[model samples]
Target: MLKRIISGLVGFILLLTIVIKGGMALSISVLLLSLLGLYEFNSAVSKNGIKYVSIISYTFPFLLFLMFNIRGLGLNIQIILFIYILSILSILVLKKDLLLNDISVTLFSLLYIPFLLFHITLLDGNKLIWLVFITAFGTDTFAYFTGILFGKRKLCPELSPKKTIEGSIGGILGSLLLSLLFLKIFNIEHYVQLGILSIICSIMAQIGDLAASKIKRISNIKDYGNIMPGHGGVLDRFDSILFTAPIVYYYITYLL
Candidate 1:
């Protein structure tokens, strides 16, 4: 418990610092996290000794970041994806040891980690980007204590036994609290949109956590990795964020 609290605090502080620093700092931090996340995911899924196109998998992330930022290499997004698809397919054909299962998992890793997380950089303003973490982390914090105090029914016993219905409500309420606070600070009046977004994100956050757990269950592992002492790995810690980032990004993009 002590380790959990300490790690959470340290991680939160580091996150707040980078978020405040925005721009290249935020982009690079998230990029590094995506790489680490991919590494952790590959490590987890390969427990059965499945061989993935590791070199290609690692290279694409760097290539993606470069394409987005380096103006000279302004290749079309479709072109980039086309090249990536062919690269992996070529490796699959050449390597008899590699199966479609490995290729599928590799594709999943890219979409799940770097691709989804890249949206954080897409958000136009500081508070908008902050919305992603605020909803995710706030819901998480409130849900933890709320569950301890009033939890009685299991939310998802098969995926995560500790979660309860009470905790789930508390999580949504937590997200609302943080999101409302955001509105107040920014002096915005779009109450309905933000409220709906907060609730949706909270539910999605829980789903994201369960989704990661589902993967771990299939792999027959207790945790993704022991990198965070109490939290497992980048995937474990950012699972909710992974699901929420895209939601927040699109909400701000088209709805608002």
Candidate 2:
């Protein structure tokens, strides 16, 4: 418990620093995290003893960052789509020993970790980015305590035995409360819209947590990495954010 609290505090400080010092600071931070997450994911997948190439895994994240930052170059959606198709075909042809499963999981990791997380950089100047953190980490914090206090029935016994229905409800309520506080602090006056978004983010955050757990179960590993004393790794810590950020981004972008 002490280890968890210490690690959470240190992480919060670092995240607050990067978020407050947005721009290249935020970009670099996201890049480093994406890279580390990719590394952890690749390591986890490799535990299944599947042989595959990681060249694209390493290279495409930079390309994704570039694609987002270099807006004036007129990089259209079609071009990005073509690049993905070409990359997949190249992998299928060149990597003879690699099977369909290898290509699928590797590509999925690319899209999952770095690709989805790159949205944070896109939200560099927006205060709503904080909502991403609040929904993700806040849910996690509340769920942990709630589970310890009143966790009775298992939420998903196979994926994660520790999770409970009570904990999940606590997480949602906690996320909604924190989100409302953020909205009030920021003086944003869209209670109806933001309220809906908070609920959606909370539910999605839990799904994201479950999804990460499923990955670990399939990989037959304990944690993604041991970077944090109690939290496991960047991916483990930010899995909820990865799922929630994109949702919040699009919500604020189109809906609100």
Candidate 3:
């Protein structure tokens, strides 16, 4: 318990620093996270005795990191993905050992970890960027305390036994409070819009947690990795952010 709290605080400090640094620093941090996350994902899959094109999974993010850091790189996604898919298929054709499931898992890993996580960079580090963390952390922290205080019914026994319906609602309330407070502090308008956004984001955060939990259940593991002592891995810690980042990004981009 002590270790978890300490680690969480340390991580928050580092995250604040990165967010403040913004620009290239944030980009590089996200890239490195994607790389490490891919490693963890590939390892988890391999534990199930499944094979995949691990190199390509690693390579694309590295290239993306390059593209992000370097201006005028001229490397487009269509071309990169075209060649990547072709390479994976060619390997599948040539290598009797590699199967379709191999490539499928590989592709899924890329999308799940790096692709979704990239939205943090796409967030572009403005006042709104803080909303992603607020939604994720607010829901998580409040759900935990709320569940402890007033949890009676189970939410999803199959995936997470401790999560209760009451707790889920608590999560939303927590997020709403935080979101409104942020609006107050930032002097941002649109109270109704932010309220709705908080609800949607809170639900997304829980979904993201369940998604990661589902993968862990399938992988037959308790935690994803021991990278963060009590917190498990990068995925364990940031799973909610993975879902919320994109939602916030697209919502602010198109809807708001």
Candidate 4:
């Protein structure tokens, strides 16, 4: 327990440093991490029997870097998605032996997994970005300890066997408190918006956790890579962020 807390604190400090710097350092960190995420996604897809995983995986980092470098009306993302879609269509047409449904599934997975996660970095320093991750990390931290100590009823028997409904509620409430705490600490002057955002972030974070669990179930593996001792892998560490980021990004940019 102490080890995990210490490791998490160290990791958070390093991340805060990189983020607070907010320049090429931050951009490169995000870019590299996103690339690592893409690699993990591609690795997962390959296990599911997707051909040309290497080519598709490499494309994401290149596309992201290119889009990041471009200056203009910011339609680069749309263009990239369009190009990806067209590429999928072309691949489907070229592979005579592949089923139409299989090709479509592969293409959809390719676009959804890495693309959505990568989109979050574009939001950068928005409150939405911080809200999602902080709430997620908060929820996960609360849920684990709470569930282990006090949980009696299992939430899901298959995907995440140990999680409890009570623990989940505890997580949400814990996330809410943490969100308010952050607002107070930062003097951000946006309480209502932050509360709503906290709810969204907490929900998405749970969803991301479940999503990662589902992936592990599919792969029949325990833990993604175990690089973070108690935390698991990079994917495991950031899964909540993966789901929360897109939601927060959209809400902050379009709705809130």
lDDT per prediction? Answer: 0.86, 0.87, 0.88, 0.73
Any idea what lDDT model 1 has? Answer: 0.86
Leading candidate by TM-score: 3
Q: Model 1, 159-184: lDDT tens per residue? A: 88899999999999999998999989
Residue 74 displacement (Å), model 4: 6.6
Task: Give the residue spans of candidate 4 off by over 4 A.
Answer: 1-3, 72-75, 95-106
Q: lDDT tens digits, residues 1-256, model 4?
A: 7877877888899878876666566667766766666566556655666554355545765666656665663647778777776776777788786566555655555554566666656776665456766788899988888898889898887999999987888888889999899888888876888788788788778988898889778867777666677776778788888777777777777765
Residues 98-201, candidate 2, lDDT per residue (tens digit)? 78888788778878888789889878889898889998888888998999999999999999999999999999999999999999988988988988898899
Could you tell me every candidate's TM-score relative to the true structure?
A: 0.95, 0.95, 0.96, 0.87
Per-model root-mean-square deviation over C-alphas: 1.4, 1.4, 1.2, 2.5
TM-score of 2: 0.95
Q: Rank the candidates by TM-score, best first.
A: 3, 2, 1, 4
Task: Give the TM-score comparing model 4 with the true structure, all chains together.
Answer: 0.87
Rate residue 6 of model 4 by lDDT: 79
Say which prediction, candidate 2 or candidate 4, comes out ahead on lDDT: 2
C-alpha RMSD in Å of predicted model 1 compared with the true structure: 1.4
Q: What's the lDDT of the predicted structure labeled candidate 4?
A: 0.73
